[model samples]
Target: MEKNNNEKLESMDTFKKLITALDAKLDSIDSRLKQQQGRKGIVKYYRNEDLKRAFGLSSNTIVKYRLTGVLPFTKLGDIFLYEASKIDKILRDNEC
Candidate 1:
């Protein structure tokens, strides 16, 4: 009877340890998933209209910046896309 009780207590302790380790692993996985989701949600490009709205500028102003090399852009066929972060920085620098 005494041996049986000791064995049961040992098993319970091992089970509790496993549960704690699994909980820590799950928390780590959740934090990694959140970081991945945040990366996925970041905008890679901005359309002309969207960029204009974001910067409170007109289409013509966008063109001027592109021509003057003040703003960098990427062309996808005939469509243009500006890096959203870079545009934000430019706007911040110009205080616009």
Candidate 2:
């Protein structure tokens, strides 16, 4: 009976360790999911020069569009930045 009790105790200890290891793996997976979700929401902006290159337009044309409100833009201090996705849509719409 004593030997049987010892065997049961050892089995319980092994089961508890396996459960702890699985919990740690789950936590790691959760953290990676959160990081991926965070990256999905991030917004990156491009400068006017980069936009001109991206849209295959001249610098002056880019300026005209900005001044005429043909393109949407954001000013961060002295730098102008455009949403890349919006620019892509505009280019697709205009076929240029």
Candidate 3:
């Protein structure tokens, strides 16, 4: 009876230790996933503000460019998004 009780207690302790180690590993993985998700990857598009700062253009000029089809854009509600590749191509084609 005494030996049986001792074995059961040892098994419980081992189980608890295993659970704690697993939990710590899971926490580490979760933290790494969060960090990776938080990082900004390659930017494929630009917003109005991005164009304004990068090219030193005003909002009015940006609007005119869109209206004249100088810069093709995608409008979502009120926000406009421009393809980075297209902008680069237009500039390269029009280079002096």
Candidate 4:
């Protein structure tokens, strides 16, 4: 009976260690997935005020740019959103 009790205790200790290691590995994988998502899965946006401050653009000029297809923006109700990637490409293409 004492030997059987010792075996049960050893098994429980091993099981607890295995569970702790599995939890650590799962946490590592979750952190890596979050890092990858931050790099590629997320779509960064710029607001109207962001453009105005970054490029010295007037609100009317931004409107004109959008209307004339010089700039592309997404309109959500009263808000405008510009994709950071598209804006970067536009600037790169137009850079002297």
Candidate 5:
């Protein structure tokens, strides 16, 4: 009876150790995912609708700005993407 109890206790200790190691691995993965998301936030991409809402401008005005080279942008097929960094620079340079 004493030997059986000792064996049970040893198995429980091994199970607890396994749980602790898995918990540490999960925490490390979560931290890496958050770091990657933070890096993406530093260089965000904006679409046409976002620009219209941000600047309170019409579609034609947005096109005019792009066509006149007032703001730099890139178009992939029908979707136009603007860099947040360049937009910030233009706004800062033209600040009143």
Candidate 6:
């Protein structure tokens, strides 16, 4: 009877340890899946052509705006990238 009691105790201890390890592994997997799913509700970037289309402005007008710092931009190898918030700010500032 004493040997049987010891066996039960050992089994219970091993089960608890196994559960703890499994919980840790599951938590890791959940975080990795979230990262792989891509970010949601993140800020989106716009390009020069996109800006022109959005504001109905010409290419020259866009270039002039960039040179004059009327719009905030990021230059990526000849491509002018703009942020949505910056564009909104410019429009708000220039509102008549």
TM-score of each model, in listed order? 0.54, 0.54, 0.55, 0.62, 0.63, 0.53
Using lDDT, give the best candidate's number. Answer: 4
The segments of candidate 6 whose C-alpha lies over 4 angstroms from its true place after superposition are: 1-41
lDDT of 3 by residue, 1-96 (tens): 999999999999999999999999999999999988787774589999999999999999999999999999998898999999889999999999
Taking the tens digit of each residue's C-alpha lDDT, what string does model 6 give over 13-41?
Answer: 99999999999999999999898668766
For model 1, the superposed segments whose C-alpha errors exceed 4 Å read 1-33, 38-43
Q: CA lDDT of each candidate? A: 0.89, 0.87, 0.94, 0.95, 0.91, 0.86
Give the C-alpha lDDT of model 5.
0.91
- Pick the TM-score winner: 5
lDDT of 4 by residue, 14-91 (tens): 999999999999999999998988887689899999999999999999999999998999999999999999999999
Q: Give the better candidate number (2 or 6) by lDDT.
A: 2
Q: Model 2, residue 49: what's the lDDT?
A: 80
- As for TM-score, the candidate ahead, 2 or 4, is 4
- Show pairs that collide, candidate 3: none
- State model 3's lDDT: 0.94
Off by over 4 Å in 3: 1-43
Better of 1 and 2 by lDDT: 1
Error of 1 at 81 (Å): 0.7
Pairs of residues clashing in candidate 4:
none
How far does residue 19 in candidate 6 sit from its true spot (Å)? 32
